[model samples]
Target: MAQPHIAKVLVVGSVNGHLADFFAKVKKLDARYGPFSILLVVGNLFANSDDHAEEVISLLKNEITVSVMTYAVVGDRPLPRRVRERASLKSGEICNNLVILSGQGVLQTSEGVKIAYLGGRYISQCLAETSNSSIENSANAAEPTDRVAVDPENSVSVDKGNSTAGNNEEKGTAGSEISKEEKGSAASESINEGKDDTISDSPPDDDESTHAHFDKLAVADLISQVAAENEKTFQKAIAQPSIDILLTFDWPYGAAATSPHTASDLSPPSTQFASNKISHLCAAIMPRYHFAAGEESFYERQPWKYSDRISIGRGSSAVPHFTRFIGLGAVNASRNEKQRWFYAMNVNPLRNISQGTSAPNELPANCTTNPLFRFGKIARVLDTKSLPRVLSAIDSSGGGNEASLSNRGGQGKRPPPPLNYICHGCNQPGHWISDCPVKGQNKRQRSDSSPPSGYVCHKCKKQGHWRSDCPADSSTSSGHASDALSKCWFCLANPDVDQNLMAAIGEEAYVAMAKGALVAGGSAKDGFHGHFSPIPGGGHVLIVPIVHTDSLRRACEGSDNAGADQRLSAEIDRWTEAVSALFAEYDCAPLIFETSRCLPHVHTTLQMIPIPNAKAESVKPALEDLCKADGLALAADYPPAQHDGYFALRDPASGNDLFLHMPKGSKSFNLELGRKLAARILGVPAREHWRQCVVSEDKEAAERDRFIAAFSKHDFTR
Candidate 1:
């Protein structure tokens, strides 16, 4: 029964050491727009070189008392290194009211507005480290960063010779102690690592390059730290994710070209603003409101609508998703002091908006040809996957014209659709892709759309179809997005899903107690009734790999070489030995198994079911008989381990276990067969069904505590 209520959010441009000006601006706004909640500050928050930066900091700590909660993105020049270390190193308090918004940082206001941030312009990490020389001498962060970002803008007035924001500082804080292993730390470079460096070819130490390099490096490092702390949340969001207000430090590359805006209308320096990475990230996040600062000009686009291309559900809708992007001008660079404008956004629950008579705040998307010329390069120097092959081909031409390919944006340039392709069903302005109302007129209409149905969207506050699943339409789904981690089970890749259920972390793997284990304690006194009692078997833990991968056999298939694969194959053996050791310590037998359903995520699921030696002896024969009945090869002896009906199989010679699936078919069939045979081998008829094993967190934690207490020495987590 939750309904949409209007919440106002304010966004300010840069505050380049002008903390007093910032406080003044918010005060004036409060008098005019008295009741706004979140205040987003873009541009350079703490001036790296400003002598008065300390005064500004003091003002923030002592003078500023406005209740409108504020968050600032790291701008062209990030906060002082001390400040960056404070925010990134510990996520420490910047001030009582204003917090520095780093990557993955969110500010939840008292009035219930959640603002998410992904800041710093796109820059390559190689360019950042190689050129800056600080990372080369010794770049070890309390917060790890391997990112490429643009140089700080020249508009930032700094001390005559000071390196902007610790680019070439080559020193950590005094008295800070770092171990030998942590010094000069480098991330395992993805295959795409050197692609961005190809553009520069040599280390460029120019002011522009250095500024770009430092901002991106710092921001990326901050982001990595934030992600590490919230590992469970970020891993889960690889699939469908929604956010309310998303803040970026720069306008998304090519975003100005989406509607009637030309390149000149967005920013005068559009030529220097080519970033396929930023553009790709903004598009992927799908936020309701996207805001950016440090642009040359100010722009507030009408809400733009887009359709979900890959409809995961049974059907789709043409009432295109409503997303708005706003750009605020630099506070110092504005034409007039009074010309600077802060945007006010209204947030409301989707249910109230959908039910109320008022339509979504929309503007005619002036689909016009943009006149952008040269721009920044589209980087493929981050990850190997999803490297635009066609774009790579264009860049390889060596014409030095990255803008030629930037025009297409992420989806590649095709001419806009013919204007005549209208939706005949809805009679709306835009042509429908899948949102047409009359797609199936002869079929039964959805009963849940009626007002009197008394239905509410479980995801959001909308009365909609019971059969339909909806995305977070406005990020107004009651609880903050960061707090809503229950929707996904395994997608949160870290071992700390719950503090109690986590047992130990291995070099590349971790252990967690399975919920509602196959055979565990029944009840506290009565024993084995349901989700209430902990599983009695002490070794029923899941061996989870840290990386997002599918099958163990195919994890390094395309990426690893022969030697790498051999090592990886050996790690599988080590994992098996670890589980075997755990069970043997308690005089039990280890029945480790793995299976994966084709899901959006790549993380593989491996379960270690420990049982009595007698039950364990029956498993091999039970699996053999079940495979024979299903016409599946004996899993352990099967030649191919990565086939469709995949389940874990051990190789006798190498002692390495790989997933063995039936040659072909969906994974579910063989997985079920494997689980059923496993249950039969263990002589547990009730636990034969996978669905029945799903249990509450408390029971899982109880089992986890026992394992943790027994095997505390095996913990290898960073």
Candidate 2:
């Protein structure tokens, strides 16, 4: 039999139906051809088109060697078109060999991979921006020297024009960095290579494959649809359109706490909010197509491809699992453009009924079992036939209306998944005790309820027990350690003896996690940032005022006063000047961050630490120190005196430790003790506050050396 000549072609188009159609044909020709070697398809292939690209890649790899590598670069812009002028410049990247056959002629390389860049200006722009930002970010990253520069204009290349076919057997020029062996295989005869050669000029025509592709596309479409529906629901709950849908990979499941939401949601110290809806959700997934033993057939490829296929939707229809959209509007807007901040105290999932105070015999109305509202044990599994129906149900008229309750037979229905099932002991369906295990448990001790008991312990493991009853640990201790390594009244708050004396214990935990890696060296293998950075403006500091809930109301009680109290205003101004001066030393400008939405007993301030030319990683520690350092210095100047006892005496030799001679006896020390000391030092009316506590036994030399090693080498002046 005569051998048919193989041709490598480059296809440029929107990567949706077209790419699927092209790959479908290749799959059908699997037995007929040794391999379809020369192929490069490029387009806006992220987001929706990403799945389609995977299918094409899978089909190609099955018949080819692993040496044949494929590349998919997300264009700098959104799909359909790309930005050419601003295309990302990936230096030293070459797509050398692939045989090229086109409408024009058999041109360029006869055995090489064809590299193509599809789309227009926007995509190119996105690519360029991403590449540049990456490089700049690297340069400003913890490892600054390894950053690379990309030449945008000259990044993409393709051999062009017409060339002779049969007469010219001349070797072709390869552009990209493809291997010689793979190049040889591109034009090799299928039968000669001892491989099947069944693929003809005709394209693929298989109904089953077509259906599968359609199903994949439908799934992608459904994700977007569901996302949109959820957004509207989120907006109604928060009374704002700026609510963001964040998917938290590590949030723990917990019952509702007190209504911290109503007490002025100023980041923390303020109580966390409570939502009426159920938050914890769990669901079982079942596949529609399960193989019957007698009917199933085993094969290397044929039957395996047709094996029992899985689909989505394993949970009950009556109680659909929903993800919560945390309203980030107030906090997001309050923060300076790109200033970084950490979430201090996290809000645990509030239960439908109050914990501890609730009765064992009766579950909250939201958690009770009602036939119309309860999900059936045997849920409908989604298959190709059922998937479309579910998607329609999610997007249809009934689903679009936000107020139209998903739960049946009442004015109130549990909102989503985590809330649907409660603990068996507590009669809440959201969690089963077997799986309702407490977090931070010993690896071997984690277990859930066989018998539904309302009493869950929150201590030792800190799950169901109150803070007062928490098991005492060696490391846990009371007291807020200020940034300056001075221990004050805040440091003595912990009952656990093992706790470190740090104001921001969470931040301290983060630093502990990053201990051994080289903190300042650069590596080529590390992610690259462009020569320029995306943060356009120079670094700046923002000073925010913190007012107690009582103080704010007293000041605002008068009808004649329409603005903030004079004393609070004066304090904010004084802090602003001091903070601005400090930022100026680092070549950064200071901006004030203040909000008049004052709540009871809560006084908080926000500071924006401008990094200017600082690397992202370096900024974290620097700013953290700045906050701590500022707090420490402020503590030193406060009214507290030696006898007042707010400040802990550090040995200076034992860094970040307290010189605790004895635990405070009730008669020995009281709230007035620290307050009196702080008042003596600062000549102010302020009490011994947690924020002003000095961290004792701090090793300044070691910390200073760490800062020098971590950031001194970087040119922060830029």
Candidate 3:
């Protein structure tokens, strides 16, 4: 296969009104990373003062030469009058090669890279205005004012109308610089300012052409437009839309904390300015590369993974996808010569990549799980109505409906199943009755009174009888027993199982250290002082039943021999108790939870995390809070009588066992809910997902050895 064509691109930080210097640097960068396809500016393109007004006018009039196609988004500073006027034109093309992307929309480059951008800082007024506007009005609301421009004088007011006065006043001192005494006095005044900051939501004056914030409804409308375009191009609803790049002026919430780099790299005030709205948008879009530039520092986060599988009910594809986030620094504003003002890279558009090949071959060891996974469902809900055709198609196929379970049990009418609903003949969701995979084979078998030429029984490994009809052994065929034992990650018989992480082996169950333990292996200071002095190798482990069962309920009820079933349950319970006792020895209590799904070929495992004794009282309330936030009902019942799937939590500190029963055929129950709740309670929210806490294989082996040594005395099976 031929290699995909790579587009060389440059992403720069704030220009800060130094147009001449910015262009000079770009020229040099082009020489080095040569003949770049395009340039993206994320921060303030123009300075607040009029020092570079001439350059701005020159660029607007196409007098200055711009070698590569350049696009800039609105930043914190107000745009100059001339530049704003030029950008307000229909095309938003300020010069021959330079363009200002004034509003929230998707920009597909000549190279086929789709860039979804929402420029400008978020303001509450934009959302309020959007709520009152009609869909048609919202779609047409992408104006020059949509870019957030903060006035230096009235920093509190986010309304674009308020900036007009400041813009007129700044024109008077255009060519002058602030005196040292005045600068010091201004700094002192700002430091002593009160905390009663207020934003104005008054309607803008007719002459006020500049706006300070992008409308939330405009972003939703943009997504709807993209979905419509995709349907026309591909003739199907894609569950996870592919965006090559996403550009925003403000950083997404938790971007710094979830990254491998410390949040300390960014100033405290900058980190506090991160936007939750941006986070939700990023989650919904799942962009391959996200770039932001509001902070004073430059930090490139390690790549993070997000699920790319098509949601075709059960047995979906297992392809992996990853995203990289880079935050650049201000241009010509170097501190100790360490901050990176620009970044260059080669990128291949998602559409150009071959079908079977992964765009990104492998994830780095430091890669983290999707940080925005928690907000994905909520984001999708916010724009469901706007995407009528796209979402309707998804609902028909049972793909993207996170609330399908709720809809089914409610008084509302259930949605009609897709035309290509699960094939009864093949027991799969891939095709309809007329196009079943085994239709031809069944006809040939009947005529010849024997199995078809390509027939192969999966259960008995014979030529006769379909795999589903094979009478070799009912137990062996049920629950996908043979397939589960061979391919399951938790089954010890699988060659891929990480034996190095296995801490202990029992007759009916086994215990292994979690691949990525929530807690670090060291003394816990800061709040956990006396309660948990030292955490031994994260103190996180998984207790798994040796039998390959989908759920504990199945293991308990699906067996012919009641005695054997009871023993299996008892052995798993014993392992949990032993792990709890071991953690208690180190002044820690265990929070064990299990997500038992009624799906085939699943190996159930109970995850245990040791929390500091001092923080034990807060665990129950935290779990309850998560349940409420996620719209889950918490029941006081310990073991549910129904054989349906459920999420059960055991809080040893409160002596309370709570369960959240999932409706049958529900695919929206978050399997990582337990880990997320635990991370919040432990005050380490970044490690909610195991991928964020993954370490080296050597480290895993060492931790396993330490856990085994400590667990030896409590080894009940031995």
Candidate 4:
């Protein structure tokens, strides 16, 4: 139960085939620093060819006696053949005490320090060759280029056969940050130069150049990947911004070129291709210690504070966060050389806050829900006096001057809860109508409703009814300010998610056929819903809470210690467990997925899919590869008690679950990640798109009916 000790991590810039020299440096460090916990290699981790492979292999095999764990981001060059040949299929160990952190993902050391990595190299090649390039061009002035003496023996060319190797890599990545003129020219240039290459170079007619657009798209994808896996990290970076250590291959473009090895004098053009992608990303993920391995000489900049729009005045300054950029240089190539560029970082888990002596990293001592450090502390704590500007913009009472939310019934009267049953009007089982007691209501309500003959309701006609007398209740009658909440897509009473699609409805949750299911449809003769070819596949189901809410993260977080919220919590747990049980009954491997944009009115949805065993095994790796390309960290492990804001599912094979925590309700999030992954595994990538699989209305009805027939018996609500 002792408090965990700080981890000493060594951050090495580039090891351009300096195997012998690197080992010598390690030995010196062992003798000097004694025992570093981790050696994080950032840039060129391997020699391109076998020129230095034998020596490096020998060192890895025979001389690495220290227990220092090693990890690396992929460099511009492909991994050395020897290492790749012996590497685990994905993120497996390459040698003793060394595991190549494959693709973008997160892992926790036994010390309990969480390490989230987005492994990628800089795509801006031109920025490396000319100080006058786009990034440097934007700088005010550079004056310390000559202070660090260059070493001829330390040339990185030893690994790639040329000192200009940094500017020559683009095999699998789009080169970004070229001069604007070059970008424009590339867009209009004859893209057919590489006509024979696997990817076409033809530029789209849009103003952006083809290659430039590709870089932008690529960087956007990377940001999206990060958002996908660590949405809370992105938001936290914006709110209560603080990251202990951040590792990237290149510094943000506007950062002072502090490295004496980089040229100080240069004139740059007005624009560059996506030059601000990294800068914008950094601004959001405000790191306390930002380390980059792009330059050849070490440079350290005093921490610079950045003030964002959400910045609050703290201790005399309006600053939200600050970042200290440290640029590391390559180690020596020869046997006995050392360089100042290598960094020895000391990270104490409790440096910023209170830490007790008796607590381990897993269970930090002196812990309370210390409101001070939680993300979004600044935004949440703002008093009304400080928020006039923000509040003025929100329509607090009515849109179109409808009744107030708190007084929907006028004069401070709370509106009745939207009918809990399908319909409150005629007391129908599956549908809600204003006059449910009307003649022939029971059997008529069982089917989809259509407005009465010759009647055209002017208001709320979208539901196929006349406006004034439409089935739309007063809650959704446009005059009600709570219309949005009442008409929430997941609310059972909403016209959009009627009981027609639900087979099993429970107090807190419901079971419905997935809109874009992944599991293939089969014959009902098997005691399950048969195939719906028009809909692509059929076994997908959605286990959702009956009420409108954000994500599982929000649902659980907002639940209070008060007994009133316990049912909400219980309902969530019941639905989750029931999802697993349902999947088990069908002999299917349950792979669930969801992402929320944090909109309270938006209900959280979990997709439960069953895939073939072979396909199921491929899901994680496939996702990891995509995340790697985008430089996003996907976490797969967590300690149960600490699992907050995370979605987790245990793999039956390993008996261990994978957990990923991110912000929810992002409009950009694809809710169909499960379908997409299944598509990859099932060899139907085209159908992976959510919109592509919609079938005709009749077919959909048939699919839904079949699902209801299969699942109605399992309805726990009854």
Candidate 5:
């Protein structure tokens, strides 16, 4: 009876009742324990009374085998009242093979005194529960195995080779007894509870599946929230100067299924119909933005930037409204480093700014009334697919003065120049249509930005010199020294002698020439002759035809025509009429007469000069004044002084000797007319013959001789 009862009264070793009691008292605290391969229990179990100990052991043995171990000192009472008293055990009752004790000297036994310390035996189902009691609870509330068995439900095999005849029969009966549903439901409940507990108590898993679902959900939710919040913001923004909504989606975000997917498989939020559908849906619900998912980037990792193309009033934030077009690009992502909020916005408020108030930092103010603004309209018209219809509409709407469909700031009175996408006028990349140099002016303020390479020679299609700087190309090169244009016939024979060499040069040198040449050209449409005409006193009515002297001589001497004189007269007449017609049609002023008889080949005659610095409002009146003095109506022949102003200034005392008055401090005494002009204008003295002279240095003589020789080959003078 004692053996069977003791087997039922199993021990919960290593865990003391005091510790368990303390844990039980603090049961409200969150206690989390889970399946682990190792467990270290630290406790003294001797503090519990025998009755309590017996009860605890019963609980332990119901699920697992039990062992009783004790660590007691000799000085301590052998049995306290809190635990079983020494009188309760018989003298020889202590079993050597059953319990383990540490630091024991002796145990009172009926037969003899014996030593006991740190010794124990394995227990075989000492605390095993009866089958009836284990299956008493419904499977719904059942727990996972508590004994840490490899396979708890199939525990009959844990003891190894010893065959259980009764266990086989028990297993057969257990299998037949339990239905599959019962096991499945119990397992499912255990797994669900484990998962829920894990999620609440532990760090979330960082698996790919988890992140993918999270990202998708987050993006969708964010889109919805942003749309809702910004809808009202967008409405208020519309009443201000400019209103543009930009939507960009990173590639590799959607379209993952269309093809064997790589990073590029993701398209930008499609500007196509599908994207518009999304936008429309959003708009219908909240009116958050006008458009979403605009055109995709032409390249990966790039997005399109947009401008409204509006001409907002000066000092107003309206410029952004009209400049709205997309700039699609793939810039390096490295540019994102050191980024800041309010990056390009004006931090200061502009409440009291007036229409013409100077923009901060000298930037051009946004102006509602500017000629460049009107020029943008022309660009917009050209940009749209329906140019013809737009043109018709423009013509119907009073041609150049058409009221803009939108209140874009375009109160300009002058027409813009022809299309020039890359404007070298200001020596900067990304030119506006207005920035182009055309018809005498570039709209932007000029800068002294020079190309890395030197200027270029357009006549020879060579670098290092501009046409103005090419002696063989034009008279300007003859006027200076240091770097003389080569006089080889091939170089000299280039047809576009007067055309700026900078325009034809390599990009680097060409840009340099463009910068310098245009600056001297006075304006885009204006030639580089100077403020005064090449031939002074020539009025706006003069026909300034810039012709190559050699070409003129060839035309004069060629036998290809029936009459060379007649051809020459006709060519001159044709040019004369063209100039007149151009003036009348475009309301241009007049051409001046500034011819150089010295250069026989290609020499430009002063056609006309519009009233110098004519205002837009006064342009018509100035043209009227010029037309009233039209060359056709004036004397058919120019006066002798007009024809030969330079020779007219020759010394009267010694006509052939030409004892001319040279300036006092001339730099070089040169024979060329350009140097002579330089000396006269600069108050420099000369020191050589008209054909072989020097003003200040021999550099001038060398340069003049080079130019004269080059110009003479085409002079056609016998």
Candidate 6:
């Protein structure tokens, strides 16, 4: 058997012209973790002053010997004129072992690591400049040096921009040049030849800039370049190319939103300087690892999974992609506390790695939703299906109007829809009928102001109108209550309920095994498989109210009979107490939580998960920290006289109660907040989403049985 080959790579933060110290640290790291195949330097390579110009000149002239092949990108400062001139002349290589990839494109190393790099700060003016027809015509007239061509042997060819081109055998560089189809250049020129222009006489320089700011055309070109390379490499229009690493100078906007830390913790200056252009680029090129600098503090965001799009009936495989964004502190910068400036990892190229079945633990527990998904540009760029809808929406607003177009751009709020346009489906003014939230509902039911044919009043249980139209006494019927129990999966009365998951039945409430349990089944001696639960069957249980109500509080409040309300609330409390006692028997502590919403048709269930006794102390602080980071206010008291939704948690071991009030119409509140918090505290973050933790039906039945056996003695209902 042969051992698998792994490529070792090292990435460091801004060098800031500390060449001597940086090289010394690299040599030590190389000896310890490397003999690394390559070294990637992000952010500022040299200081703004002329103090280090001599050192840069010496290194560029081959006087300095670097232990590894070095590649650097332009950062916050302009590159030295001498070094830039030498690198451009030598096709991006400054010396024997050092190279400067100053342009925006992908570079594939000898070890097959595909790195996508975008250098410099963002210039907002570039958007306006690129939109100018005269400047665009002039740019089109200039000899295009950045055209991407396909190579038969290499599959793709790059230009002076150092795109996804093959390696140059003569220069020992990563990219090679290709012959221009004079026809291709002529076609582009012909399209813009007769355009009205103010500056058509002066053509823009064709040379790549070493300036501290990048042009918007370069960003668009990079996106198109990456897309073209994917088409060439995979031979499919929608195939996602695997980019191992992405290097950028500044952090992407909203990078700290989903991270465990807040923007203030990761340097507010850096956060303020973040760019949405970078965010758009990151979304387009979903790299495995994204490294950035310019921030003086080190911060590592939780890994985020890319939104998976359905395949377009093409033969392309749907592979899940994830990106881990790491912001490194400046090298040798003075700080109150020591921060990490270097990162090293061993990786196998995506081509070398198998694209087969992945293990259950493949995704990290701390993985989160992509922060860049909020940007609409990402949807327009990556999702071709949405293009028609977007274009139609824009066209309907006005005839080629820039103001109407701006409404659909980025994250900016749009003006209210015209009063003349109303959605017949929901009787709303903001959206078209086809885009209505209730579009799937029967048209007769919406327009007739009457319930459906089989409708029964939940309040009166009479066949006719809904609970809202019920003629029952106002005092007896709660205005907010609705009957959804007949269709609810958690309701025992539902014929479709999974009986195999039911553990115990009571007069007011019932106990059942949680579907997609966060914890795995095993004994403590078996070791932690992903969760901290020591009890068998993962110790995940759910207590559900037998009545159809949005929440337990609503069930109690809406009941006309006081006795029935008290009994329902007490029965739920007893079930929770019983489960806590059962977990105590196994030396585990119970973490019980519930989300009570005022919304109609919401089935409320209390989730009870067991954690190790040792970890119980850390749960409250972790939850509080996450809430604070997410800008959620946790109050010591429950919601006061509010019909809105609120989250409640009980920590019996710590004797603490916490509540987060979710006001009505607050779309920002995350419904999965509790599950995410529990997953993090229990060390099963990957299983936060119930869909990911679902097991087979047979396995679910077995877990239910095991839990019932363990809770037999503690079953108060029996």
Per residue, candidate 5 scores C-alpha lDDT tens digits across 1-718 of 1110000001111222332332232221112211111111111332223323443332222222222211121111122221121112311111111121212111211111111111111011112323232101111211211222121111121121221111111111101222234323322322223222111111134321100011222222223333333232223332222112212221121121111222223333232212211221222122101211112122122121112342223534443322111112111111221210000111111111112232211222321111111111121212223222222222222234433223211224334443554333333334333333331221111122222264344445456533333446443555431122223111212322222111111100110011111011123233223432221111223222222232222343354553644545455555434433433333333322232333333333322332222222343333234334331112223233322221112111122211122222332212233223322332332311121121221222222233222222222210
Best by lDDT: 6
For candidate 3, the per-residue lDDT at 671 reads 74
Tens-digit lDDT track for model 6 on 1-718? Answer: 4332345667877877766556766777666544666788887777665555556655654555676767788886567666665556656666555667786877777555678888887765233324222100011111111221111112221221221122232122234431133212322322124231211111145453333677555565565556555444433444444567889886886576435443225432336457756766776667778888856456777677754441112224434556788777676664323356766675555533333221111445556656655332333223334332332221222233322223332122434468788554444467644344554344212345666565555456666654445577342334423334445676544545665466676657777788778886687675455664567667888888766656666555555667877888888888888988988877778888888766556688889988777778887788789888768878887678656688888865567888888865444566677788778876777777675666655466557657766886787533
User: Per-residue lDDT of 1-718 in model 2, one digit per residue for the tens?
Assistant: 3221223222221122233333443333322321323222222222222333343232222333222122222222232111111112111111222222110111122321112111112111222233233111111111111211111211222222221121123222112333455434433412223212221211234321100011112222333333232233222321111111111111111111111121123221211221101111111111100101000011000000000111111222112222121111111112232111111111111110012121111111222111111111112322233333333322222232322212221222323336555453333355433333442232112243222245443334324543223345222242221221121111111122111111111100100101111111122233112211111111222222222222222332332443555545444444444434444454433222222212222232333322222232332233234335323321322122222222222111122212111122212222222223323322333322322221221221122233323321231210
lDDT of 1: 0.45
267: Cα error in model 1, Å: 7.8
Each candidate structure's count of clashing pairs? 24, 117, 2, 18, 65, 2
**Residue 234 lDDT in model 2?**
22
Tell me the TM-score of model 6.
Answer: 0.47
TM-score computed on alpha carbons, candidate 3:
0.47
Query: What lDDT score goes with residue 248 in model 6?
Result: 86
Ranking by TM-score: 6, 3, 1, 4, 2, 5
Assess each prediction's global lDDT (C-alpha) against the native: 0.45, 0.23, 0.59, 0.44, 0.23, 0.60
| Lowest-sum lDDT 10-residue window in model 1 | 135-144
Candidate 1, superposed: residue stretches over 4 Å from native: 85-92, 105-114, 125-241, 262-271, 308-318, 335-339, 349-718
RMSD score of candidate 5 (Å): 38.3
List TM-scores for all candidates, in order: 0.36, 0.20, 0.47, 0.34, 0.18, 0.47
Q: Which candidate is the best by TM-score?
A: 6
lDDT of 2 at 400: 29
Candidate 3 vs candidate 4, lDDT winner: 3
Write one digit per residue (lDDT tens) for candidate 4, span 258-372: 1212221222111122123344344434444566665544555434543234333233343343445566656652121223456665554322222222221122121111111
TM-score, prediction 4: 0.34
- Looking at model 3, which ten-residue stretch has the lowest summed lDDT? 165-174
Clashing pairs in 6: 158-165, 365-686
